[model samples]
Target: MSEVKEMAAKQERQALTGNEAMALAMRQIEPDVVAAYPITPQTEIVQIFSTYVADGLVNTEYVPVESEHSAMSAVVGSAAAGARSMTATSANGLALMWEILYIASGTRLPIVMPVVNRALSGPINIHCDHSDTMGARDSGWIQIFSENAQEAYDNMFQAIRIAEHPDVLLPAMVTTDGFIISHGMEIVNTLDDKTIKDFLGTYKIPRNLLDVDNPITVGPLALQDFYFETKVAQADAMMKAKPVILEIAEEYEKLSGRKYSFFEEYRLDDADVAIVVLGSTAGTAKVVVDNLRKEGIKAGLLKLRVFRPFPYEELKEALKHVDVIGVLDRSDSFASLGGPVFSELRAAMYDMETRPLVTNYVYGLGGRDIDLHMIEQAYRELLEIKETGKVDQYVNYLGVRE
Candidate 1:
């Protein structure tokens, strides 16, 4: 951001719920098309944006679909036709779009969806949890998790650039916790419409369906031979997304003065025990770490921002110095071992010459509350692991009554 714009942005910070902040960001960016289906916490976003269209605030087509499945389909169709497109949805809504999610990324569409993280259900819930997004980790989309409303707002612009980057034309989802970030209000420093417009520049696709002079097919069925190659190509693009994500983050930081990375490190230098987490719970964990430090305990936190295109190598180097690390997951993978994050981190650290002793802490599934006490217990376990040089159990559930 320019110095004057930055100062104005700081002064004009608005108190908004995550949904309102995201909708406002969408308005600022003003993509060509927005096709969405509302569910619980995510409903407010499109509801707010729909009013923008009605009031002539943004020149964008707003499609209110019957279901999340149709919502994703609408964006995919619009994006393939070379329009900048977006959507928003919550847990069950996200699940409904499962099939189309893969097709969106597989066909290399730079669609952006803001997902409000909620527990995926058989018991049926409408509250905060990571199960919804965690279940779609391998669906060929870039997954960026937000800690609060501010990140949710900022990430929308960054996600647009990242998804539309020349080398990384993949669908992306920026997620915030349901009820936690989505319904709660916080002050967000927002860029002006002109700044976001300049940041996004223009939306272009090399071979869009609408280009009749240079017609090309999209989403054709591929059998065993070519399909394997397509998968490999998509994987290559996903790996390429890491650098693109970071580069865009640096540019965004210069613009907004809010730095972001694959993960955030909090006082890791001299700490012996640390906690690794994702989403809003990281905020709670930070408080626990702060209190632990005041008592002379060497504790720290690493809050992960990007889950898909997992930063395996960078993460290993970051945590190798710590003695014991507690990797917390808000979703249960239920493989009889632990959650998705624990398995990935353990594997990532496997080859580190001086790796930290890591244990899994599965907490806050189905929107169960994880208070400061739960985070403190996680740190306590880490301290014990550091002191004894032993991990009694690799997988442990937190704040749950057996």
Candidate 2:
């Protein structure tokens, strides 16, 4: 017989790496399976989780896969078998798992991955950039970006809920800044075991997939006749997921007192211009907005929290009041006329009869530093775009000396 041995209750405060925070979050949730490979800035997350399994903190299957492709494949298998499974990766590791990422989402498996957003290499650099994840943006999974360690931990908690929601039964990616957030240590207010358990409840194993008495086939090979309908079904699931994401975010706010939206608005209500950004760069933009406000200039930050199922309606409403909007794309979209995120936002607002003047400024490419002054420069560039009506085709590399 198994006994219920309890860990001592202690509300101890300490600084923790984003990877450690993510590990603790997974510990609290007690996933049924964890399938992952060792990837830079993401390896520590699974390493710590492995320790928990050794210590008996979590009774689960820990699959140490040979490669990232196998890791993601393991997750799809576990999730389809009706187990709550998770994985983490970055850069080349994400690139390797490209094929399975789509398979997991298309099959409507609720597996979650913490993508430590990193730059792809031509000459080889393992630093922060959204290039890898941005490359997979078209995959059917829901994507959520975290600005810092705390948000990284918080979003991990929410990812499971959002993914498992019946209407949103798709895989999800919770992204954090590579090396920046994943390696940086900070104070994180993690939920207690009881509180987290109450918040998440039991992982409601889906009846169709997990029923042992009624065995069913999953991932059945579909012919060309049924392929189109499967594609449409996946699209319908993603569209339904948007509201479920919002609803779960609201529920998380009620439980933890931290509210998130499709995009987080920082002092944008009265600002003449606001810079939009995702990931840790948004934190830099926030500080710049504060400093700009002190100088009596109306400036603000619009942080994109949800990148996939791109919150078009919510974003349209959020940017309704601003006069000029500057989008800071961390990842460049070559051949797209401008940066990736900016081009998407520009297209979203292009048809709107009453929309703010949108401009694009690309920054922080190849793991570059995005300081407050750089953000200030971006705001000024947007002002120029508004006044002169000229938007640059290439990105405005932040802090570059040219």
Q: Considering every candidate listed, which one attains the maximal TM-score?
A: 1
Per-residue lDDT for 320-396 in model 2, tens only? 77878988887788767677788888788887887888777767777888777778888877777767765654455
Evaluated against the true structure, the overall lDDT of model 2 is 0.84
Residue-pair clashes per candidate: 1, 0
**Window of ten residues with lowest summed lDDT in model 1:** 3-12
At residue 322, give the lDDT of candidate 1.
Answer: 94
Q: State the lDDT at 270 in candidate 2.
A: 85
| TM-score to true structure, per model | 0.97, 0.93
* Top of the candidates by lDDT: 1
Off by over 4 Å in 1: 1-11
